[model samples]
Target: MSEEQLNFDFFAELSEPVPEPAPVKENVDGADEISVEPAALSEAAAKAESSPETERGVTPFVLRQAVLGYLAGQQPTAVGIRVPTRVKKFQVSMAACWIAPQSKQNHIEKVVAIDIFDRREHCLPDCAEREELLATLKTLKLEKLKLEKVIRENEPELKDSDDLFEEFQSYDYSASRNTAYHKLLKQISRLQHVIYKGSRMELIRQAAVADYLYLAVPAGELAPEELADGWGLLHVFPDRQVKVVKVASRQQCNEEGRRHLALNIAATSLKSVLFANGVAVDEHLRVSFQPPPRRRRKRL
Candidate 1:
C-alpha cells in the first residue's frame, strides 16, 4: 500500500454518503432507537481519564478510549466495549454496530482487538537465561511436589497439634524456599507471555464477528504485517489520537452471524447500564438489583 493508503482516514470514509437501500418494513423491536455513538465514546473516555497511567506508559484503557473516539466520529449506530464475540470465551475489545438501510437490522460494522505489552513481557531475558529459568522452574515444581507428599504423609502426626505455629514449623521447609518458588513462578509467567505471541490476533480471527476487523496497539509498537490477513491496523497514540495504519478488507459475514454479534453488543450495553445502577448479573444471565448500604445519621 502507498503511504496515503496506509495512512487512510477511516472517519472521512465513514462520513461519506452512500446510496440508501430501499426501505422494507421489518418487525424489529428497538429498531428506531437513537444511535448511542457519541455517548458511548464519552463514557469510555471518561473511564480512561479517571484511571491511573500504567508503569509502561500508555495503558490498554487509554488505547480503548482513542479507538472509541475514532469509531464515534464515524457515526456508528451503537458502540460497545469488551464485547463478547460469537466464539465462546473470546471477546473483542471494542465493537461498533451499523444498521442496514433496507432491513433496518443491526449488524456489526467494526471490531477492534487490542494487545498491550507489559514491561516484563517486553524485557524478557535472553535465550540462555530463559532456558535456565525454565530449568529452575521445573526443579522447583519437583521439590514442591515432594514437599506436598511429605506433608500429606505427616498429616496424621500433625492432626494432634493445636498450635498453628508449631504445625507450620513441622512442614520441613524454609521461608527462603517458599520465596524462591514464588519468584520462579513469576519468571515463568513472563516467559509464557513472551512465547505466546499474536494470540490476540488468533482469537480475533477465530471470532470472525465483524465485517471489518482491527488490531489496535500503542503507537510505534506494531508493524502493519503483525496484523492477520484482512485485518486493519490502528495505532493509538499517547495523546489518545487514533491513526489507521492499514485499512481492513471487508470479510463475508452471514446474516445470522451479524445478528448474533449485534445481540451480544446490545446485551453488553445493557449490562453496563444495569451495573452502573447497582444491579448485578449472574452466570445464568439473571439480573438482580442490589440497593446501596444505608449510612447511619449522626445526632447533634
Candidate 2:
C-alpha cells in the first residue's frame, strides 16, 4: 500500500469530530468580543484538513499511548504514566528514569506534560493582571469582614434564643449584608479561576523533578510560540508515531528530586497493580483482597 493510503486507513479507524472555531458574539453592552480572526480561522481549518490526527479522532488517551510506546523504545530503567509530581495539584502525564552507566545508585529522570491545543482562549491573566486581581480579592474580603461587623452591630438583642432566631429572619440589616456577601463571593470565585489557570505553568515548573522536561501534543495542534523555553516538544501522529520536534534542555535534578520522582512512580505503579488485582481500598484507605469463591464439582 502507498504511504498516503496507509495513513488514510489508520485515521479511518478513529472517530472524533475536529473542534470548530468559536463564532464571534456581541456582549450585553453591544461591544464586539475579541475572537479568532476570519483569516486565522481559515488557516487553522486548512491545517486541520491536512493533518489526519486532527481530522480523525486522536484523543488525549490515544496520544498518551503513542508517547508511552516511544518512551519504551528509549529503554528506560523505569517508566510510568499519570505520575504525580512533587506538587499535588499537577501531574506528569508520563515519567521515566534511566540508571547511570557508571553509578548504580544514580538515575537520570525525565518527565512529559501532555495537553490538547484548542484555539479557545483560556482567559488566563498575565503577571500584572494576576497581581491586580489578587489585590482586588483581598480588598473584597476585607470589605466582607467590615460588612459582617455592621451586621453584628445591627443585631437586635433578644434575651431568648427562639426570639433571636425570629428577629434575625426579619432583620433588614442581615438581608442587605447577605446580598453584599454573595456579590463579593461571585467576584472572588471568578478571580480565583483566572488565577488558577494562569498559574498552570508555574505549577508545572514546580512539579517537574526531572533532568529534562517535555510537552507532547497532536501534530500541528501546538505552535512553537506556545511552548515554554527549555522544554522539548513531541508530536504524536494518528498512526501512533511520535516525532521529537525539539530536544529538551537538561535541568539540574538533585538527589532529593530524583528520589522523589522515583517514589511517586513506584507509588502510582503499586496502586495500578493493586487495582488490577481487584484489591479494594476503603474510604479510610485500607487495602483488602477478596478471594474468588470455589466452584463445586458436579457428580456424574
Candidate 3:
C-alpha cells in the first residue's frame, strides 16, 4: 500500500496543466507596469556610462523642422529663416517663419519667432536637489533606451540562451522589474522648480513685436515654468510629431523694428537660398540691404 501510494500520482500531478500568473497592475502613466528586463537595464546602464556627460539641450536642428512644419500648418504661406535681433546691445539671432501679405490691402507682415530651449544654457534649477534629480533621471532614461536597443540588436543570441537550450537566459529580467524604470520615470515626470529665465530676452521682444511667437522644445522636456508668456508651445518629437499645447496670441507687430528685422531676415535668408547673396550695409543710416543686380555694358 505504501509503495503504490508513493508511486501513485507523482508523475500524474506533473502532467496536469500549471496555473498562469495573475495580470500585473497598471498605473495611469503606465510606468507601474514597466517591463524592461535586466539585460536591457544593464545595456541601458552601459550606454549611460559610455555617453558623454553633456547635458540635454535644444542642439537638434531637427526640432526647427518640427517648428517649420507647425508654421506650415498654421500659416501655409509663411517661410522660415534665421533672423537676428538686438537684445540689450547683444546681437542675438533666432529662427523666424515669415508670412508675407497675400493682398496689398492688409499690408501687414507676419513673423513667428521660435525660441529653442538649450538645456546647456537653460533648464537648470537654483535648487541643487532638483537639478541633480533632473540630471539623474535623464541618465536613467538614456540607459533604459540603450538596454532596449541592445536587446533588439542581439535578439538571436538571447533566444539561443533560453532555458530550453539547456542553459539559463543570459538576460536577468528580475533586476529591472517595474519598480526601477517606473520610479525613474516618475522622478523625471515630477521634476519641478526648474526655472528658465526666458532662454533669451529676445524671446520677450519677439512676443511684443512678432505677429506670432512659438516655443519649440524637445518632446517630454520642459522648464519648470515654460516661457508660456502667451507664446505657443510646440512639443517636437524624434518621430517628427509636433504637439501644439497652446495657441499663440498675436501681438501688435512693431512696424519700424519689424521692417528692419524683415530686411535683415530676408538678406540673411537670401545668402543661404540665393547661392551666395552678399549683404550690403548703408554706412550713414547703419541699415542692411541686398545689393541690386549689376548692369551689364553693351559689347561692340
| Candidate achieving the largest lDDT | 1
lDDT of 2 by residue, 263-283 (tens): 777777876676667787888
Q: Which 10 consecutive residues of model 1 have the lowest summed lDDT?
A: 30-39
For candidate 2, the TM-score is: 0.49
Order the candidates by lDDT, highest first — what do you get?
Answer: 1, 2, 3
Put down candidate 1 lDDT per residue, 124-207, tens digits, no spaces. 222333333334433444444444444445454543344455323333333333454455445434433342233444445556
lDDT values for all models: 0.52, 0.51, 0.43
TM-score per prediction, in order, is: 0.49, 0.49, 0.42
Mark the regions of model 1 whose C-alpha exceeds 4 Å error after superposition. 1-56, 103-199, 276-300
Model 3, 48-154: lDDT tens digits are 22443224333355655655555555543335354555442222224443445556643335555665543323322233343444444444445444543445354
Candidate 1's TM-score: 0.49
Model 1 / residue 130 / CA error / Å: 15
Off by over 4 Å in 2: 1-56, 101-198, 285-300
**Candidate with better lDDT, 1 vs 2:** 1
